[model samples]
Target: MRWFRKKSASTTKTIFGEYCATSSVHGVRYFSDPERTLCEKFWWIVMFLVSVGGCVKLIESTWLKWNLTPIVVNFENQPISVTEIPFPSFTICPPGKISKLMYNFAKEAKQIRNSGAHANAYGSEDCFSTEFE
Candidate 1:
């Protein structure tokens, strides 16, 4: 038997076959190769499916986490020298009844009321602090 074999004209290159052979995606070349055994092809298919499944699961979890989260606006009570904040930069206060957990206006009011010297001054001033739980 001759070691060197002649090239056959019977084997034709189709569009899909050429694409699969030269695909940029990983494992496609080996999976599409005609010379590879059935076991090798099956293994490639399994690996491809596992990678796809992992990617899909990652994307799904991320999407759900992003959507399920509530929009939060955090503010600190640190004293500022400026009486009023300039335009553009501002604080976000919750609408309706503010949660006692976040802030207790009643407690602050009680402290101010107990301070004798400042009691009259605070009582005279028009303040929104009167509306407390």
Candidate 2:
């Protein structure tokens, strides 16, 4: 049984190796080739290093641009007030805010599955009643 598992794992690896050798990506086939010569292998390594260096340079330039650029926020010369902003679209209600007896998870999940529509997991009306506010 152990030998059979090992054989299957080796077969999977062989399939992956075949894919890498046949892939259209440059330098991959050479790198994956089992019979590649020393010179070919050296060239592949050099190509891989150059590709990695180019990627690093690209990321460095992007990082420098992001850091060097100034982000200016204008408040129109007026005091900023939190109340001026609209209320959040949704609020998470704590367990104490909603009665566990009234909320049935299974029933709500079944309703959503049957209807194939999204329903709020928690009842907004019960949780946001005027009394709670």
Candidate 3:
């Protein structure tokens, strides 16, 4: 199988050459023409303002339909209850209280270590057992 095939022809003519060439004429003239008339500038400004207004209207309608309208409908159908909603509540402990709790935890951990309870809790005797096999 041939991996790299050379193109048969150079300077190939495209079927839509006229369409592409005609389409670029307006864009090229709009950008490259320095001596534009006042009428052209006014026309461009009108087009820009109209486009912006259209975009704003589109966004407003979309927001109303997708976001605001649904919220309003939901509120009208089923009113929100404070007790039914599970709002997050935080218990803010002082730094001193947190430190005291940590100290107590460490003391209990040290006692468990001294009593050999921590070693037995790990069940190290089962480490070499082949009970599963």
Best by TM-score: 1
User: Model 3: how far is 32 from its true place, Å?
Assistant: 10
Q: Work out how many backbone clashes candidate 1 has.
A: 0
> Candidate 1, residues 1-133: lDDT per residue as tens digits?
2333322322334555677798999997777689999899899989998999999999999899867863433364764433254446778886776776677667677666456545477565444335444
By lDDT, who's the top model here? 2
Per-model lDDT: 0.69, 0.71, 0.54
Instruction: Write one digit per residue (lDDT tens) for candidate 2, span 1-133.
Output: 9999999999988987898788897787786687999789789979988999999999999999877864444467875554465555987888788886686576665555455454354544243222210
TM-score for candidate 3, residues paired by index: 0.29
- TM-score per prediction, in order, is 0.43, 0.38, 0.29
Ranking by lDDT: 2, 1, 3
Cα RMSD, each candidate: 16.9, 16.5, 21.1
**Could you tell me how far off, in angstroms, the CA of residue 80 lies in candidate 1 after the best superposition?**
22
With candidate 1 superimposed using the best TM-score fit, by how many Å does residue 71's alpha carbon deviate from the native? Answer: 6.8
Q: On a 0 to 100 scale, what is the lDDT of residue 110 in model 2?
A: 55
